[model samples]
Target: MKGILCTLLLLLWMITGCSNNSASNMENNKKLAEAVKQETEMPLEMPTDFNFMVSFGYGDVTKNVIDTYEGTVTKDLIIKGSATAEILFTADELRDIYDKMKTIDIMGPKELSKKGNCFQTPSNEDLWKVTVGGETKTFSWTDQKCGITEDANQLRELRNYIQHMVEGLEAYKTLPEAEGGYD
Candidate 1:
């Protein structure tokens, strides 16, 4: 009887341990699935008609120009938009532009020089700016006829696109050399 009782207790303990491990694995799998889903849901391409303008001012001369640029939100990073200008700069140029624009240095009104991620004028005009190399550019609604609120949705989308691009670039930089391989 004693032998039988001891064997039965041991079996029960083993079964409970197995069950606990199974539960833990299931929980881990669930978390992993959620992470994967979130990553996969990120759009791989930027939405159509993602247009923004960049205006530059030097002393008394201020030039406002418009560029129809496209963007992509890849699993690795987000690309807001690229200019159609003939001047082609490498990836480094793009990164420099991104870094400069992420802050509100030359975008804000002349009165308020405070730095920010995005800038807004007193007239409720919102502008996004970026600097490449030493040149600073500002982007705002060119029409000047339509209010910023009119394109609020589009601006919001652009903001999200920028965020994703920044995150992707950061992730790519941290990846191991073996994973990226020689390109």
Candidate 2:
């Protein structure tokens, strides 16, 4: 009878211990989830002295920022497809772009790696210049290898975001389209 009682007590103790550990594990999971939620909800801050320019086009025909309020975009044509106009950004928009750049650590790479094999001729180049505080960084990358690298992909996405914003502006809409095509 004593042996049976001891076995019953041992089983009960094991079950209680397991239940306590399970409860502790559940609490830990909840804490982890909350931390992740808070982190994702946090907004990224933009630098005070931020200025940036991103441009892209085929071959030598490209676009560039002339100043804070003006830029030019040349089409992929052999003749007369360039349009110079206002390219302005609001504080909130600039902050959003800066946040994305920071998230990808754009300034971290001096040159993006050309990892995969690329045999095709050069088709396009995308350029970026960012100034924060007193430091300025400029980099250019081609569409060679179809932007296979992680850095290239991220930059492409950033460039696309900028392009979408610019194209939606009234000033950009007023620009003339290309009249000719490359040979």
Winning candidate number (lDDT): 2
Cα lDDT tens digits, model 2, 11-128, are 9999999999999999999998777655433235565667777667665666533334234433232466466776667888888887888788776653475757764455567777
Summarize candidate 1's per-residue lDDT along 114-152 as a digit string, tens digits.
Answer: 333553332223345443333444545322233334344
- State TM-scores per candidate: 0.26, 0.64
lDDT of 1 at 39: 43
Instruction: Give me the runs in candidate 1 sitting further than 4 Å from their true place.
Output: 43-183
> For candidate 1, which ten residues in a row score worst on lDDT?
73-82
Clashing pairs in 2: none
lDDT of 1 at 33: 77
lDDT against the true structure, per candidate, is: 0.40, 0.68
Clash total of candidate 1: 5
